[model samples]
Target chain A: MPKEKKIRVLIAKVGCDIHERGALTLLTTFRDEGMEAIYTGRYQTPKGVANAAVSEDVDVIALSDHTGSLPIIAEAVLAELKKLGVTDMPIIAGGLLTQEDVKVLERMGVTGNYGPGTPMDVILTHIRNVAC
Target chain B: MEVFLHNLTGIPRVDEAISLMKARNIRGLTRAISIVENYEEGRDALLNDAFQRASEACFTLGFTGAPGVGKSTLVNAVIRHYRRSGKTVGVMAVDPTSPFSGGAVLGDRIRMQEHNPDNGVYIRSLASRKALGGLSEATKYALYLYKAFGFDVIIVETLGVGQDEIDVARYVDVTTVLLVPGYGDTIQMAKAGIMEIADLFVINKSDRPGADLLKKQVQNILYMKAEKERPPVLNTIADQNEGIDDVMEAIAEVRQRKALQGQERHRKRIVEEIRSSVLTRLAGDAEPHLDEMAGKVLTLSMTPIEAAELIIRRIQKGCLEDDEKNSI
Candidate 1:
């Protein structure tokens, strides 16, 4: 039997930041592009996000961060995934990132680090490419 | 034709998954559900083996109703209640798959995020893909796997349903239908399909006006049934956790009554599972010939009825030939 491959994404927001208009927009965009996107909701801990990704068996983990804790939250989530022996899972971040935060995500091997005003098409294409 | 008990051969992942499931590994449950959800190769083998190991220790609860009835919110409250007692829960939240894109946005988990990383609570979102009955086709198989994994409670939260989408009742041990105040009047309560399936009725958002009126309407609807057979109607403000304890108590009472007829439920579920599996297999086998037959009909070589009959005859003949070959 052949299975239909869907790009399953876990879209989430880390601690204390409830600015979700951007994340919700991106989630809808992913759905429009025919991806199975699930948002774990706001104020999620790194551990919660990591566990949800593994349990949902999502292809990519997209974080919607706005509290300037992108690097910290991304690192913790990556570490938690590592604890579950999930090392190569694709991690992406968007919202409220400075140049330094983007560089930090790059060093940590996170893909598609986008800030506000970045084109939705660019984010979508990058996600499709990485997930595939 | 073959012995349908167990066929773990040619599927190495099943071996690993079974072992993981034995240890209650979350990843194993996740992988097992994915295999069944996608109908991947060896899905039946996995499900068959899971059935053999599955136990009746878990209580399967179903929550279904129209949109925005606070089903997920109520489920969240129930999960907290169960977690406080140190019981393990496995939740499957069903949302509709987009008919055009064949994709879905599973937002149910957003409501249950507080339970994450608890290990005692596992919540998975399912897309109601191609299943018009407010459930995924793999739901029954997923329940078997969850049972094998030894959860104390298994909850299936269905997509917001209309009148006739009551398939969830067939698969669960207890079905709780949620309704908010002002949802409908007495006529809607007396309707046949969704109202008849519930073992319990929940008027969530009971803090709103008309809550008492809805409860009275439900009681009037249940007035015809035997007192023992009547499902209890309870009020709840799920977000603030008001009245959840009463709802839980009503559920326990209903579950006790439901347990008495467990064998009947099991028999019905067996028939349904087999019937659906055979239909799905036959459909898959017949799918490859559809385009050719449609083309023949388009060219006026055959009528639509004749085209369908031809396909059926071919499939029947093919089945006989395969049987003969196996016998030889």
Candidate 2:
């Protein structure tokens, strides 16, 4: 019998960001939504995130940007994922984003750009929609 | 990396996976562990193949005790000590699975943040999924995977449930059961199954008042048994990073002692694994009969052991048939 697969998400803090309050807080939020969430602790590089994402076999990679490092970090992480032959693993951005930033990130192949204080219910719904 | 080329499609390539694992590719090891953990097709065969081909000689160290003993904190301390000597460490920290959500919080990763950036240390957190032993049943397989990943030391940390205390002994070469001062009933816990299996007994949080008493109780328990080289009982305040050196030395001593025993203890562990595997399979097969059996036990009509025997007899007579044990 084929066992049912659970949605596994990698909640990570990318770049040299120390503002992990959002990332740490979202750990249980994802788990409560019936998703297996693995947190990447502080000081994560894009290469490390890409490696951990591939190694952990996570379905979604959500990057929490505390600094303004997401644009470059996202591009580097996407390149690293490409190195591993991953093209469409939904790379989502959360926390402290503006409309202009969202437009730029979406144009650069990021699937979702969510802002701070976005309800977990809405976030999980979007993840389920894109992930499934 | 070349070995992972086999499982592009179809069933998981057990042989190629073994090759990739032997060469210590993190991606291959991670994917293979996922397959076994999820109980995908041929999971047991893959694990058996890898067990035979890759990791028959890796040393496993187990850390377990009752909850609130700072097991994770102590694990972080030991991992740091090992890494100082240029040894690679792989940690498997198990936490309880959420019954409502079926996902684990996995808080151990936060405590082990120091090793996150260290390439020499690899940490994987597992949820104790439906295994009565209070461990992810595939933990032993994870140990093998980590061993094959070029780690010099593999540590398996249980959720500290009493049921899983003996389970760690099946896989590890050395076991350290951590206790704290003023642990309510330390002496009573010293009489548990976990204490008997320990190669090193640790009194963590030794800064507290009852630390010496706990040590005395553990010593008394050790004295009751006959032994050649007695298992050392030591004190440590792991959170403060005090006494970690003595703990490491005790582990080294125990490793040497286990090596001296050779295959004698290994043979016994295999026997225990076989028995445990068989009984778990039997119970799984007789699941439909369990409610009635429980009712009989409640009514005092049959003992649990009798019920087990009856299940075994039924299985032997072809009355119950189930899948093979995929619990590593």
Candidate 3:
């Protein structure tokens, strides 16, 4: 059998909201796909996400936020990444997102937005297409 | 003296640095690690030289949780227990940095000061530097430095509550998630992502109200999930050093299990390091072009999707270059 090099990814939940089932699901999915997945757990600031991204040296960064405040949180994180000169990293966000919220994240330069109930396979595909 | 001081500010040549580290020249190694962590100019040259000098002696343990969860006190108690067993310990207490001044509060050390004068104990307080995960970028190098110094155990304490602290679990051999009873609802514990990553659950301030109920709740939840294994829950009053030995025993047992299974936590850490290094390099390479890319997107000269595609391509190119270099 060929040795598999797991593509590393960091999955984090940003902001004050503590919901993480979706984030955990993503972590599981990434690992199932033979990816080395490190989950940052919950209540991450944008800097925390970026730092995890940098330190974990992830191929992609997937953020899960079920709370409705994704716009402000996304902006805060993306802005911090920009300030830190890490704007090259791909960021994909998921959670209980509205269509409008998806639009906002898209404009903010997120790779893609996955709303609630999106299949794990679908999220995985997006992650690979954008991050790998 | 000037050369020594310069080496203190600069990265040391590897053999000299490693010899110094083995000699437990804490100031020299600490300065070297600080330079690496800060990515100070010319630090890379020093790190390359020192990288092989350290002995990789210790297993790293990361303890993390919300503020007021008694993480510092718990770490102190755990360190004290380890010291009793005649183990040499290194502690890195990560504190939050003031956003305005870029200085740290360094509060985690205050609770752990009792162990300050012990030769067996080495404690260093680090400011988060606004980096995510409440860990300094130079953490890996610092671990190597400690390992070179012959420490058997390295414990990293996080700044505050959240995902960054949880991420520490990935790097350490065993991660203990600390919970303070009555901070929030039982649902908060479940929601915090600590449920999945923590190898052991520490209910600090067990003397507090609802400690038993919280323990039962966690146990029941663990049973319901019925995963491969359930993390053991221990009650502790860290302030009083109660139940600390049991916690240490649990840690030792887990370490034994991990060793018996032939699982190299260091291998996982190395993989993480490679990934982090590659991504950081890719990101660093692409950073210089962001303004150009952003300008194209903002001026309507390039569509957002196209701009993103271009950036991704550039990052991928960088990764490819890194891969080729590593292979050679």
**C-alpha lDDT of all candidate models, in order:** 0.86, 0.74, 0.68
True contacts kept of 2: 0.29
Best model number under lDDT = 1
Q: Rank the candidates by TM-score, best first.
A: 1, 2, 3
For the predicted complex of model 3, DockQ is 0.01
TM-score of 2: 0.81
**If you assessed candidate 2 against the hidden native complex, which CAPRI class would it receive?**
acceptable
> Model 3 over residues B1-328: C-alpha lDDT tens digits?
0101112322245455545555565545654554555565556666665556555546778888788899989998888887877887878777665555443334454576556435467666565654566565556556665665667788988778664345577677778888878756657656756567788889999998999988888787788655546778899999998998899888877776666534566677778778766665565566677789889988999997898789889878877999999999
Q: For candidate 1, write residues A19-116 as lDDT tens digits.
A: 98998898788878888899999999888998798778788899888889999999999988877767878999988899999999999999788988
Model 1 per-residue lDDT at A107:
99
Error of 3 at B303 (Å): 4.9
| Interface DockQ per candidate | 0.47, 0.34, 0.01
Native-referenced Cα lDDT, model 2: 0.74
Q: Rank the candidates by DockQ, best first.
A: 1, 2, 3
Off by over 4 Å in 1: B1-12, B290-307
Clashing pairs in 3: A42-B163, A48-B132, A57-B275, A57-B276, B14-B49, B14-B50
